[model samples]
Target: MCASPVKKNEPDNRKGQAGGDSGPASRSRTDRRNSQAAKPKREHVKKSARDAALSVLTGVEEAGSYSNLKLNQILREADLPRPDAALATEIVYGTIQRRNTIDYYLAKLVTKGLGKLQPWVRSLLRMSLYQLLYLERVPDHAVVSEAVNIAKRRGHQGISGMVNGVLRSAIRQRAELTLPQGMTDAERISLEHSHPEWLVRRWIKQYGAEACERICKANNEPPHVSIRANARRQHQDALLEQLRLGGFDAEPSALSPAGIVVSSGGNMALTPGFGQGDYSIQDESSMLVAEALQPEAGMTVLDCCAAPGGKTAHIAEKMDDTGTVWACDLHPHKKRLIDEQAQRLGLKSVRTLVKDARELAGEFEPASFDRILLDAPCSGFGVIRRKPDLKWGKREEDIAGIAAVQQSILEAVHGLLKPGGVLVYSTCTIERTENEDAVARFLEAHPEFVFDPIPTTGWPESAPLEQAASGMISIMPDRYGTDGFFIARIRRLA
Candidate 1:
C-alpha cells in the first residue's frame, strides 16, 4: 500500500519515483500511513458505487448525457448491491438536479472558476457535497473518504489534495454559505433557488418572482407516484386494499376517483398486479382528461396525439371497452406503445393509427366522432417535477413556437368534431398561450363551437374556476400536487 503524492509542478519521471528520489517516498511505514491518514484512506482498490456514480456524473457534465437514461444504463451494467446502487443513483440525480447551487458554493470556496477545473474534479466535488448536504444516511467521514479515494484512482496526487481541501472548506463554511445578494431578480432566483439563470429570468417574466420560486422549489422535491386504477381489473376500494397488501402506503386521490397515491414503491413494474394490468402509472391530473371527456358505451372517440395511450385506454375503460377508441400519433413506432397498453388492459375496442391528426379531415367525414381528445404537444412546463431538465433546457421562444403548432392542430380537428360532440383540448404545460389563447382564438373563428363546462366531479371543490371567453382549466403544479397541466372542454353547436 506504499504510494507517492503526485505533484503537478514536478517533472514526469519514468522511474515512478517521487520528486526524482530513487528511495522510498516516505522515510518509514508509520510516516507513510500517517501521511495517508492526514488526507483520506483509499478503502477500495478496484471501485465502489460512489466511484461508478462519479464516472457517470463526469460523463453527464462533459458529454451532456441525459441524467436519467445514463444513470439507468450504469445501474444496469454495475454489479453493485441494491443499496449501493440506490445511493449512487441518488448522488448522480441530486447533483444533476442541484448543479447550479453546488457550483456556486464551489466557486465561492475555490480561487479558480469551477468551469475551468477538470471535469472529473468538478463531478467529484459535486457528488461529495450532495451527499454531505442531502443524504442523511451517508456519514460525513464516508463522504470525504470515498471522494478522496475516487480522486486517487482517477487523478494525480495534487488533484486529490485539492479535492480534499475544497471539500473540507465547504464543510467548514456550510453555516455561512449564502448566495450573493443585491442582484437581478433572475440572478437571485437562480442562486437562491438553484435553477439555471436563463430559466429563472424566463420564469420571472412569465410568472412573477414569487411564483417562479414556487415552481423551482417544486421541481427539486422528489416526485410522487400517482397511479390510475384499471377499472377492468378492480374497483378503487379493492385496488387500494391490494396496494396496501403489496407494502405501499396507499390512498385515493381527492380529485380523481380512479387515482391512487403511493408513498414509496421501489420499482412499479415489479409491484403486485402490474403484470395483470390492475393499474397503470399516471399522474392525477392526466386522469382528469379522461374524466372530463365523459365517453359512454357505443360512442366513437378519437384521442388525437395519443401515443403511449393512458388517456385513450382510460376512455375505453370508461366506455366499458364497448365503443371504438381510435388512438392516433404521427410516428408509426409510437402506435405500438398504445397497442401494447390496450392489450395489457384487455381492452379489445382500442385501435391504433399512424396517421397525422391534421389529416383526419381526409380520412373521416365532418362530425364523425362522438367525442375527441386533443392532448396537444407542448413545452411541458407543468411536469417539471418528473422532468427536472426541462427547467434548464426549455427557452422562452420555444413556448410560443409550440403554441403555434397547438393552434394549427386545434383548427384541423375542429371540423372533425360532430355537432354536439365534445372536444377536450389539453397539454402538460402551464403557459397561457397554449391553453387560454388557443381556446380563445378557436372560439373567435368558429362561432358555432362553444365551451363545454368540466363537470364538478372531475375537480376538487377547493379550486376556483376563472371565467374565460372559451372555458378552459389551468392546473398549476402549485395548486394541485400534480404536474402542471391545462384542460379545456369544448363542444360544437348542432
Candidate 2:
C-alpha cells in the first residue's frame, strides 16, 4: 500500500532554457535576469479537499493506480489538515463506489459524452456530483463553486463553463435523475449498487437474485476498521477497555473473539497501542484464518504467501510466540514487511523467508511443518468494500488465471505437512472457482487430505449458514458486515 514518491524534473523557464536555448546562454547575467521577468511565474496554490479527491480519481482512471495507494501518496505530499484529509478520503471512496450511477446521471447532463471529456474533467464531474448528491453536510453552492474554481485552475474557461453548466443542470434535475423502470434485475442491481453488470449476473447465478443484490449493496458501504488484539501482550477485553478509555468508540467484534470494531476516533493505526503493537489493523473475517488453522504452542507452521504480516502475527500471538512460524513470501521486500511486523509485535518465533509457496516442495524438506497456511493469491472480489478499484480493474477472465496459481501452490504445500498435520486454505475472494471449487478439486486429487468442519465451539449461534461444502466457509460481506472471505481447513490423514 506504499511507494516512494517520484520526483519529476522541473522545466527551467530562464532565457536559454526556454524552447531549447535560442543562443541566450552567451548573454550577460543582466540580460538573463531581464528575460526571467518576461513571463510571470506560476503561483504555488495548495489543493483543497475537492481538488485532492479529483486528482485521486483521475489517477485511478487514467494510470490504473490503486485508489488507496494513490490517495495515501497524495495526502502525504499535500500535508493537508486532518479535516480536509478526511473529507478528501470520503469524496474519493464515495465517488468510486458510486461511479456507475454518477456517470449515468452525468451522461444525461453532459452534452459531450462522459468518455470524450478529459480524465480530470470527468473525475471532477464525478467527485462534484457525488458531493452534491450524497454529502448532505456540504452546501450545494459550495460544491458547485469549488468545482468550477478547480476546473478553471486546471483547464480553460470553456471547460470550466461546461462544468458549471453540467453541475447546475444536475443540481436542478437531481430529483428526476432516478434509474428508469423496466430494466432487468441484473441491470437494476448493477446500476443501483454501482457494480459491474457481468459480476452481478454471475453472483445472481451463484447465490440467487436476493443474495446477489445484498452482496452488491453491501460492497458499496464503508468498510469497518477492525483491529486484532495482540493477545500475547494484551487480552481482548483489556485492549477494548484501553481503547474505550482513550475515547475510541471501541466494541468487541461479534465475528472474532480477538477483534475490536472501532466506529470513531479515526486512523487507529496512529494510536499509541498500535505503535506498541498491542493490536494490528485487520478485517474481522480475515482474523478467522489463524483461528481456523488452530496454531498451538511449540508447533512449527508455514505461512505461505504471507505479506504485511497480519495473519502471521495472529498465528504467532496464538502460540504465545513460542512456536517457530516460517513466514514466506515471493518478494524480499514482502518478507521484510512480515519481519518488521514480527519485530513490532515482539514475536520472536516468526522466521521470514523470500520463497515462493509454489516452489516450496522442491526446495524444502518434505513433511517438515506441523501446520501450513496457503493464504493464496486471489481475484480479490471479496474485498471490493475496501478496494473498490478492483471492481473496474478486474475482468471475469482473471479468475481462472488466479485459480490456476492457487492450485499450483496448493499442490506444492500439501507435501510439506506431516501426517495428520493441518493446512488451512484461505483467500479474500468470493469466487467459487477459487474458493469452494478449488478446495473441492484439491481434496479430489489428493485423497489423503480431507476437509474438516471449521471449529465453531465459541462462535455465536447465528454464525453457520449454507455452504457448497461442509468444511469451507464463504462469509459474504452482507452476511456479517465483514469482508467477503473464504476459509477451509483441510488436514492430511496419515
Candidate 3:
C-alpha cells in the first residue's frame, strides 16, 4: 500500500520509452497519437467490468475509502449493465478478501516488488491474480488480457509491459507460487487465509492456534444473508411461509428466534416481502442483541450509537411497538436511516434523535430508562466476510483507539440506566480487550453496575453456549457460523 501515484508512473514510462518501445513500429504516427492520449490524464476510453473493479480497488487503497461505499458510488455513476455490475462487484470484494494471499503470490513473481509499482498497477496485478486463482468462471486468458489492456490504456507501454509480465509469470508459475516454506503457523495462516498477521497472531493468543485458524478460515467465506421477521406484519413462521410461497429457500435462524437464513433464491432485499416490510435484512448475530436486551411492552429503552437502526427496530418489534425506543446516533443524517426502517416496518414507537451517545446522559435525566442497549463501536473485525476492505484498512493501533470510545460510551450510559434496569453492551468484534476486558473495566469503575446473566431458559437449543464470563458472551465467527459478536448484560444495582 505505498503512496506511489501517477507522477511516479510518468518517470517510469519515460524510462520505458528510452529502453525499448516495442520496436520501430512503436515510433509510428498512430503510436505517437495513442501515447499522447494516454498521457497524464490516463482517461480510460472504455470502462470494462475489470476497469470498474480496478477503479474501486485503487480508490479504496489510495483514499482510504470503505469498499462498499466506494463500490456503491462507482456502480451508481458507471451504470454498467446488471451482469457487468455483478461481475465487478464479485471481483471487487474477492480481490480485497484475499489481498494478503495475492500479495504473497506477487512477492514470488514480481522482480520490482509490488510496493514499487504505481497504486493502480499494484491493484490491477492483485485483482487479476485473484480472478485467476479463485474465480473458476472467468477464463485465465481473459483475466490477463483485461489487466494488460487496462495497464496500457492508463500508462505507457512500459508499465503495461510490467503488468503483463507479472500476470503472465503468475499464470506460468502457478504451481510454484506455494506459501514460502518454514513460515510460522501464524504466518502461514495469515498468507493462506489472507488476514493481517497481527490480527491472526491476536486470535492465536486469545483463542489458541486451532480456533484462530478456524476463525480466519471462516472470515474468508461469503456470508449468508439473514433477515429479521417483522413481528407486527407477521409471525416468524408466517414470514417463513411467505418466503416459501415466494420461492425462497429459507429457514429459521439457529441463533436468533426472529432471524431467517436465506441461503438461496437471489437477493432477498429485492424480494416483495422486503418491499412490504415483512422482514428487515440483518445478520443472525446482530439479531441476537434485541432479544438479549429484553425490552418489555410500554418500557423506555435507549439504543446508544444506533445507526442504520437494525437493533433499534428489533427492539421496537420485541416490545410490540407499544413503547418508546429512543434510537440515537451522533450524525443527524443517520436519523433518516432510523426513520426509514421504522416507517418500512410500520413501527410508531421508535423515536429518532440526533445526539451523541457519550453526551446522552446530558440530554436526558439519569435513571430515566428501563432498558439501554449500548452496541458500542469497535474494530468491526467480526464482519470481514461482508466488508473485506476492513482487513487491510484496520491497523493494530485502531483497536485501542476504538476501545477507548467503547469504554467512554459504556461509562456515559451507566448512569442513564434506572436502578435494577438492564444495559446490554455489545460489539461486532472478537477482540477480548474490546469485549470482556472493556466490560470488566466498566464493572470495576462503576460501583452501581453489576453483572446480569442473560437467561438461557428460552435460548435456541441449536445455538449452544457454555456460560458468560463475567456475564458476557463471546460469539466468535467460527462458533455459530455467524458474524463474530460479543454481548454483555449489565444492570444498575442500587
Candidate with top lDDT is 2
Report the poorest 10 consecutive residues by lDDT, candidate 2. Answer: 12-21
The window of 10 residues in a row where model 1 has the poorest summed lDDT is 12-21
Best by TM-score: 2
Candidate scoring better on TM-score of 1 and 3: 3
Candidate 2: stretches off by over 4 Å: 1-43, 465-469
Ranking by TM-score: 2, 3, 1
Model 1, span 52-144: residue lDDT tens: 687667666666665555666666556777667767766766677777777777788777777777667778888888777667657778889
> Candidate order by lDDT, highest to lowest?
2, 3, 1
lDDT (tens digit, per residue) of candidate 3 on 1-494:
21111111100000000011111001122333334233323353556788778878887887777777777666656777767877787788878988988887788788878887767778889888888787766788998888888776666787777778888887787767676677897897898888999999999999899999999989876677788888877888888887788777899888887788876455565667777888888888888788778899999999988898889989999899997999999887788888988998899999999998889989899999999999988889998877888888889999989999988888787888899899999999889989999988998988788888775555678764455435677788887788999898888888
lDDT of model number 3: 0.79
Question: In candidate 3, which residue pairs get closer than 3 Å at backbone N, Cα or C atoms, i.e. clash?
Answer: none
lDDT (CA) per prediction: 0.74, 0.81, 0.79
Clash pairs detected, candidate 2: none
Cα lDDT for residue 415, model 3? 85
